[model samples]
Target: MIEVENLTKKYGDARGINDVTFTVEKGEVLGFLGPNGAGKTTTMRILTCFMPATSGKAKIAGFDVFEDSLEVRKRIGYLPESVPLYTDMQVPVYLEFVAGLKGVDRRDVKRRVSHVMDDCALNAVSKKYIGELSKGYRQRVGLAQALINDPEVLILDEPTIGLDPRQIIEIRSLIKSLGGRRTVILSTHILPEVSMICQRVVIINEGRLVAVDTPQNLTAQLQRSQQILIRVGGPEKEVLSEVGKINGVSRVSVKENGADNINAYLIELKKDMVDAGKDIPPVIVRKNWSLHEMRPVGMSLEDIFIKLVTEEKIN
Candidate 1:
């Protein structure tokens, strides 16, 4: 329900985002990822109508962002990295204020405020001032305000920046629950959050769109070969020779396992033979080598993020 086309922003020559473009379909949760200073926030601000782009166009719920700023803002709920909050107000009061500002009917304000407070697990501290709450509670308060109006689009920037592990999981679950009902654009440097919560990812680096695809697709796109780690008890040279002869085997290298007589090997299979892991053990058994371990090595999101960002710099 969100579309950006060549969205560019600048502060008098210092670039914010250049030719940034992507889309988030209805009920789709899109993870917006980038390193620091990569323009993630700038892009989000423009989409949320918090700021105007120097050039280009953005639309939310089929309304042009520039032409229908009020409509766009009404349809989107934004929780910025530093949530703008009234520290002196109690949680319930603060949320009620936000609900009113978001155009929630005066008669429905109490029900809306209470529902969001419950959804964010802030009911117990409803009467407590925001400043008196812990960082995690404060973050929840920020999220509650964003949900007060139940907008069709939610734009969150660093929603779980400083929370502890437990708190992070709570917030992550909350975000996940909102999927399929709200179009969400989550902007964060946390890779695992994207992997666990986002349906697809849009990666930017140095203020340019680097890649946009499903996490699995991006990993597969960058992978040139399949890798398998195997541990066997046998003479190193003999084991290597036997495995190297297997069809689709591209290369074999021995790795130190720190155990006597037990050698580890990293086998690289040709790109077309991704399932080569299934063909390895039989070769070892025929040679009388005792296989200890056999597992595939998959590229994680962290690895993919670093690889893509570094490649962008080199090119």
Candidate 2:
């Protein structure tokens, strides 16, 4: 439901985003992932028409963001990084005012405001002032206001940042529930959150679109070598040497131990071949080394991100 092509933005030679291009399908939740200063927020701002790009084109819900900026604005629900809230106004009052500004029919304003308040779980605090509420509640109020117009697309930038653990999960669940009807493009550095909620990811770095794929695919390609950690009660030297000699086993790395006892080591294998958990235990048993503990070290998304983006920098 969103398309950006060669969208470039610059501020007097200070780069914002360059050569950025991507699209989000209808019903797709696209996770915009990158480190800070990676131009994620910059892209969202351009899409919302909060600011125009220096060059290139973008369309939201099929209308050009610049040419049909008003139509695009009407179709989008944007929860920017810092939700601009009228701290003095009470919840229902603030939303009602927003509804009028958005040109909601006077007869339908109450119903519309009530509906979003319910959806965002703000019904209980509809009488509370925005400034009096905690950060979590204020964010909920921001989201409530964003939904006041019932826009078809939701563009949330770091929506859950600075929230406590409890607040984070609650907001995440709320965002997930808002799916099916609204296409979402969420920009967050929280990798796990992206994997959990997004159908696909658009990873960017240094104003460039680096990679776009399913989280599973990205993690798998970078998982070239697998490693296992093991602790045994018997001869560490012999067990380490023997595992290194096995077919498909590439290297052996051991942890430092006291002079009299050494019981732990890391075994590396060709990632595609050896099932380290199934193979290594038997080897230690055959060598008469009491295998106290053995566990495979699965590759993580963080590992893949660091490897890919860091390599991009060097090249």
Give the poorly placed runs of model 1, Cα more than 4 Å off. Answer: 258-260
lDDT for each residue of candidate 2 in 140-243, tens digit (9 for 90 to 100): 88888888888889999999998999989988988888777789999999989988988888889888899899888887666777777877766666777888
| Candidate closest to the true structure, highest lDDT | 1
lDDT of each: 0.91, 0.86
Model 2 residue 241 distance off true place after TM-score fit, in angstroms: 2.0
Candidate 1 whole-model C-alpha lDDT, 0 to 1 = 0.91
309: Cα error in model 2, Å: 3.3
In terms of TM-score, how similar is model 2 to the real structure?
0.89
Per-candidate TM equals 0.97, 0.89
Give one digit per residue, the lDDT tens place, for model 1 in 173-240.
99999999999999999998999999999999988999999988988887889889999999888888
Clash count, candidate 1: 0
